[model samples]
Target: MEVTYLCPHCIGAINALDNIILSAKTEKNKHGLILLHEEIWNYSVIQTSSINAELGEIVDFFCPVCHASLNTEKGDHYAGYIRMDASGQESKIVISREYGDRRTFKITGEDIESYGESARKYMYPEWFL
Candidate 1:
């Protein structure tokens, strides 16, 4: 199954692989000032240089297109939402601390129960077992 990430703000595609998001990290430039550097899969590292080697703390992942915070809640350690589509089946998998650390799988189009099961199996195998 293929996955795609969309910017919640602009609804723009962010990465190519649709798996594993490399968030921006702060680094110091030659002037010793902090700057945000992001590296996307199959894409060149943004603002990476010899002088900017010190990796700083990353608060949250942002939408590369609109620069919107991906996390649904403030101060969430890690959050992710998955949009799945197969054989005319559409579903959304949202996992976030704001939702009480639960995985919400919403399926639409056809076979709601069956599609939800399949999505859960493909997305989180451990949940089934």
Candidate 2:
């Protein structure tokens, strides 16, 4: 089954090949394109050499199309977008912005599922709805 990632702001397709691509900027002002595995639980990253993201460093993410900042408005150290599954059901996907923090959340209405190294039950994020 395939899943499509979309920019919450622009609703533009953000996934290509087997990766989800986003524009990112490190706290130190280094910018690059970030490629993350389309598989939600995979933490592997492919980014330009300019982005030397250190552990716990916040890397700001933006939609490649509309350039909308993906950061969650609550400043909870996460960035988010929409994920549409093959069946056309949509969910909100949120991931930690801190480099090396493998925290991810998939929120479908009131159901919140988590994945990655730091997976945990999460509160339903009304802002992402």
Candidate 3:
């Protein structure tokens, strides 16, 4: 089943061709497009040649459609959006904003499903939801 990701603000679909496209800006003020693998936990990423993002570097993620920042209200350490499965089940998807910090969370109601090795850093994932 294919899952579609949407910007939390504009509710615009963000995934295309199995990649979640997001506008990104690094701390160095470099801007570019970031393509993240749509499958949760995959962690495959591709950045435009214009950007030079180092591993473990944190970058700002934004909705490519509305240009609204996707940074979670919880903290800059994560970015969040909405995810809908093929059956139309929707939930909140939060991911580590820092490059190479493999943490992802799927929040549905009071339930929190954590994935990736770095997810262990957050012992209680429900607080963010």
Which candidate wins on TM-score? Answer: 3
- Runs with alpha carbons beyond 4 Å of true place in candidate 2: 121-129
- Give lDDT tens digits, candidate 3, residues 1-129: 789999989999999999999999988889999998998879888999887788888889999999999998776588989999999988988888898888999888888989899889778655676
Model 2 TM-score, all chains together: 0.91
RMSD of 1: 10.3
Q: What would the TM-score be for candidate 3 when compared with the true structure?
A: 0.94
What C-alpha lDDT values do all the predictions have? 0.36, 0.88, 0.89
Ranking by lDDT: 3, 2, 1
Name the regions of candidate 1 deviating beyond 4 angstroms: 18-22, 25-59, 74-76, 88-90, 93-129
**Of the pair 1 and 2, which is ahead by TM-score?**
2
Give per-residue CA lDDT, model 1, range 72-97, as digits (tens): 45323433433434353334333322
Better of 2 and 3 by lDDT: 3
Candidate 1 TM-score, C-alpha based: 0.39
CA shift of 71, model 2, Å: 0.3
Error of 1 at 62 (Å): 0.6
- Candidate ranking under TM-score, highest first, comes to 3, 2, 1
